[model samples]
Target chain A: MEYQRYNCGNCGACVAVCPQQILKLNENQVTKDPGCDECGNCTIVCPLGAFTWKVGHEV
Target chain B: MKYDVVVVGGRIGGSIASLYASKDDADVLMIEKRQEIGTPVQCAEGTTQSIFKILDMKPDKRYINAEIDGATIHAPDGRAIDLAEVSCENFLDGTGYKGYILDRKVFDKHLAIQAAKAGAEIMMKTTVKDLIRKDGRVCGVVAEHLGETMEIKADVVIAADGVESNMARQAGLTNPNKPGNIGSCAQYELFGLDIDPHQLNFYFGREIAPGGYLWMFPKGEDTVNVGLGVRSTKKTAYQYLNQFISRFKGTTPVELNIGGVPLSGPIDKTYTDGLLVVGDAAGHVDPVTGGGIHIAAFCGKTAGQVAAEAVKKENTSESVLKRYDEIWREKFGKNLEISLKYRNAADKLTDKDMNALAEFLEKNKIENLSKISAIKFLGKHPHLLMLIRDLL
Candidate 1:
């Protein structure tokens, strides 16, 4: 999934639905570690549409 | 650092758990990732009076914005069903004060203060990075605060974490919530919106919120919380909220809040060995209404009582902690299950169905809801009969 960080609300919606648990939420920013299986759970749960299915952005 | 219990998150669940656990004389520590207990509020702040009953506290105006006695539900065809005109027999949850709109920013911190007064230690701005496990059983947590990492040991760890909870996942009590089961929501606190200050308004239609609905909750003094939730949709909930907000002129948002609510029923398991899960972490939220404050308070109290008992017994094993699950389930399990069923059935409703139901209910107001009138209404809206049957 491609993350539009600027649009992120830091609501932690992505962190809860991330099956791999790779997402981490900070006070002001949300970060992701490597090893995303790309289940696209974050894409649908985000209130701001921060995460998107980009197919192969940089894989 | 070591304590009898370490509760993650400092919202309704965590603070209540901390308060009850401390009241029972168990050494407790509650951790919060945010510096403040409640800010950037997520909820529409509507909660039943049952929560105050559960907390054994009076409704203090410092945190309560408005007291609502009724609600107005708007259908797709512009029909309105005023719940005040209906009798108690029509309500699914039975008769009581409808609800209260809370200033969560004040309420959350007040609850945390109550926990502190009850002897629970609180650590702010600390995030638990991982759980501390020993011998295949969860024991405590490794947390970070201001770049300092520390491992806090506790006999039992209560995961009162919110929607973004990972402690339960790490302990193997549950998995991530499916997107379909989550209510992706956005709210705006508007400064100048004129409406009934004592009544709640709900708008339902696919165009308003595809999988969910929109709510306009009056927060006293010309302020209101307008929000919506949707699921599995390409358009974000924020966009849906903006479309609905655009209708009211001369209104500007003062604060924008975003959140995700787990609409699934409680998780398969709430406790495993030394760990207990409560609140949104355990999916204690009611699916039909997206409300969890009362459920969280009840479960938090139960978990705290159980945790204290386990500590006194000198055993914090799964066998001892499982009592928490039994107690909360016995109180709310069947209700949540029924609500989830209703939510699933309601998800299938179309604009025509909603308008038909609204029209039917409005005609069957308290004075007109006779036996023959009900039969005639059903005869006219036969499809609604099927829908209600499916819900049941």
Candidate 2:
């Protein structure tokens, strides 16, 4: 998955609400856990709509 | 790029900070990572009129959705108490106290525009990658703007970067929130709502919200912002919001927002060498009410003024900038401390205690009480007093 590099405000609202606890924020970039499932919870919670799933990428 | 002040985050706090700094003749830049200033609204969009007075801003119809005359609190068992009369007496100079539900998108954008007009540069879609520290003092920021990495230098950096502030950590300040200190929230703007247009409604119960309350604030004639906040719950805020929205069978949400609020007091430290933290990043919110817009504006203005003075004096050291903390704390710290005590005590209250408190409000015919007043009233009861003795 490719997150919007410029749009993540680093608010960590996405990290806090992620059900699987797979999203980790390093400064402004969010890294997904290897055990991630694409539940889209992070996307739903990000205030800036910063997260996006790259096509053909499977978690 | 170089500026005297670089304010990260372009919402209310950052914009306001930039506005004051620019007005003080400091070169200022406000950066926001979002494409828009206030898209994907995160709050219930409710605030008191006192905020406008603090900012010396006149109320604009363009961003006001509704003027709330009073509020009604619903007990878990459906008992209701209206607060109109007492609220009027205490807050409104004997006229009715009116809270406002704002169109946050418009309101935030307006504040940013005000900052820009005051000579502050605003850069949207700019994400601060990290703070640029020189000899353990923050001197600038590395940010990504338009897919390009740019290093922006500043004499002072203000972190208005919302709830999860990387700047705070970069400055070596402890996190402002603890596990139970934050409340998860989800809000929905619904149309075709059948409810009182002038009174905000709050519902309290463990089942409804484990450690917080749910609210429905009227937006316009037939619309409302319905939301809930909860802390230390097994259920997600979304689940609680879903269950709460199920009550309004016919109403459909026009907008959905999920966010978090710091329910603790302000952070112990809000200023570091060459850096200042304001607004949600500083946890300048009411613990009991989960309100921060006013506090954010208040602290933002203070930080900006202090930052400008420091810049002019060539003393942006932590010792000099610490005045922002002292001034804000002297102004509003006691209230926040009291709110924290009350929140901690109230969160421990049982469902039975809540029912009893509701009963007391009903039986005593108390129309409204401030958080402190409510705590005092509850303190009068031996049982309730014992429950919250440590807080008292």
Candidate 3:
């Protein structure tokens, strides 16, 4: 998995949309779990561009 | 007589701000224009489960009528999207949380109670006529209380005055909302109704309420809060709500809240020297959904904390209070900005496009719907999808 900088504002939109408990708010910002499988579940779910992929893909 | 902090408008943000300030060794006071807390409620009061964590209090069962797991979004063509239910706290703690349908009047009062318990003096039905300024900085508020115009002194003032935030405008922290950012919403608490109590229902139709959606929230076995929100561009919330209620074919209304949501983007600046703006007053509602409860609370708490910190430092400059805005922006600003872009995209969607989207969802699993796939689903209809793709 390639590394990316996601500014997750922690509104929990992604958490609200995530099927799995892979994302959460840490210190008022959103964070993904180490167990996250990168199913693009969060990237697809993010209303904002807060979630991103290792390789740039159409959101 | 003076105070360390004075919060104007005892709504969600104001109440929370007062509580935060008072709890931190500040002499805080909260003032409201209404005779009672949370009266003449304007909100649908549907809030995400994250509220508990935001307030750091367990909501008494009386305030929370039910815990909403999922929602049913029905399109104008009778197409529906069933958003899956996730654990409420998990949603906020991790990805996000479930929301609650509250009686805002009760909830707002509860918030004030928390503030009062924190040692903030609560004043009701008192209107702030203007800001008290000195050397080009705000020092307090000039308000009318019980037929007397009075000046209350404070080092800093927090404005949580809701949509028509004249206090902020008078202080020059924000301008009155432009027409585009306002949403007119109207709802009826209908008695004697039969509907799903668990699943919140949302309806979208071009003819029903253009530029907005209708909602049916079952309060209990026979009572429901049914309402519609239409963009001010299309019609007044009152006009759309009246038409929607007529189509209800349900029992008579027992109560009603006809109001507008300031879906406007957050003000460019939320603070001035000695003055801080919070809640709907600062136009902090979500751009797409026009929901402001959780965010209002979040910002209010932030404002309260920042004001308290400022008091500790003996500084109340716009620069100092600006920490509150920075915190709020760091937390929710970017997301709201992105949602506004989506709002632009959604507003341009035609009736045919909406109907097509509804039809597409009708044929698919409602549980799988989200922004990405929803866009993808809409993209399937070559013509409609192409239009959306190009626009997005």
Candidate 4:
């Protein structure tokens, strides 16, 4: 998954809603830990539409 | 780099603080993590006209979306009660009336611009990583700015960093929002809604929002901010928002926003040695209504003014910074206490209880309701008072 740095406000809204608890906000970007299940929760919870799945991968 | 004051966020509270601090001729710098000042907006953007008073200027046409005269509340049984006759006075100024739905992007940018014009330096895309402490006092911050890690020192640091504040924790202050204190929220900007453009609407029901309410605030002729907030529920706010959106036909949203609201009273302490926390970072939101813009504006200005004065006096100790806390608490503490009490009482109310309360208000010819009024009404009815006591 790729998150757009330009649109992210770093509000940590996505990190709060992530069920996997893999999302962490560092500096101004949200990063996912290796226990990676692409649940798409961060993509949906982001207020700024900043998160997007990598190309060729379905959310 | 060293400054008289360093504001950790460039949102409404931070911008206002910086503006006032700069007006006092203090060297101030505001840092924002986003590329744009107000990108990925988090507010419902509803505030009163008295914002003009705080800004000390007339209303700017660029940011005003709609002027609201009153509100209409919908009960769980679909009964609508108009509060047009109710006086919605400004909580601070106490003279002005009417609500406004703002274009937040423009409004926030305008505030930052005003601060800049007043001699405050604003740096976008700068994120504060941690506080630099010396002998238990926050002396500066370590931040990542423009791909470079740098240390910025300041006489005073203002943490207006929203609900997810790191400054408070770094300063050794406990997070004010406990498990049930924060309200999870989701909002959508929708068009093609058949809603009155001059009034706000609120829908309340446990089935809809367990411990919160749904709101429809008009932005323009055909656009509205449709949103919901709930606390401590098994379902996410997104699910509740989607379920609410399904009820309206022929409406599609153009934007989506999600965040958390501190529905608790102000934090136990907002001032630490050489540091002050304002806005949502300080939990300055009303517990019952989930409104914080006015509180933010009021407290932010006070914090800025006091900080500037303290710096001028060459003292940035917690004792000097404590004045900000005292002033704000004197102004808003009782009101917040009442709001929290009402929230506690309302949390225990069932759908039937809410319906009865609404009907009772209608029967009494009460058009406008406030926390004090609600308490008085409950006082008159022993059964309701008993219910509230049991819940508490």
Please tell me which predicted candidate would have the highest DockQ against the true structure.
1
- When sorted by DockQ, best at the front, the candidate numbers are 1, 4, 2, 3
lDDT of 2 by residue, B319-366 (tens): 999999999999889888988888878877887787777776775554
TM-score of 1: 0.96
Q: Could you give candidate 4's per-residue lDDT for residues B41-101 as a string of tens digits?
A: 7888888777777778788769989987778888988888775444435432353437788
Q: For candidate 3, lDDT tens digit of each residue in A1-59?
A: 22234533332334433334454432234455666666554443232234456766543
Native-contact recovery for every candidate? 0.78, 0.10, 0.00, 0.10
TM-score of each: 0.96, 0.86, 0.80, 0.85
- Name the better of 1 and 3 by TM-score: 1
Q: State the weakest 10-residue window (summed lDDT) of model 2 chain B.
A: B85-94
Q: Compared to the true structure, candidate 4 yields what TM-score? A: 0.85
| lDDT, each prediction | 0.90, 0.81, 0.73, 0.81
Clashing pairs in 1: none
Count: clashes, candidate 1: 0
Colliding pairs, model 2 = none
> What docking grade does candidate 3 earn?
incorrect
Clashes of each: 0, 0, 12, 0
lDDT of 2 by residue, A1-56 (tens): 45786766554766644545566554336676676667655554454457656687
Q: What are the runs in model 1 whose C-alpha is more than 4 Å off?
A: A55-59, B88-97, B379-382
Model number with the top TM-score: 1
lDDT of 3 at B199: 71
CA displacement after TM-score superposition, residue B142 of candidate 3 (Å): 0.3
lDDT of 3 by residue, B204-291 (tens): 8777666677888877666788887775333445556667677656488887765556666788899989999998878788887777
Model 2's CAPRI class is incorrect
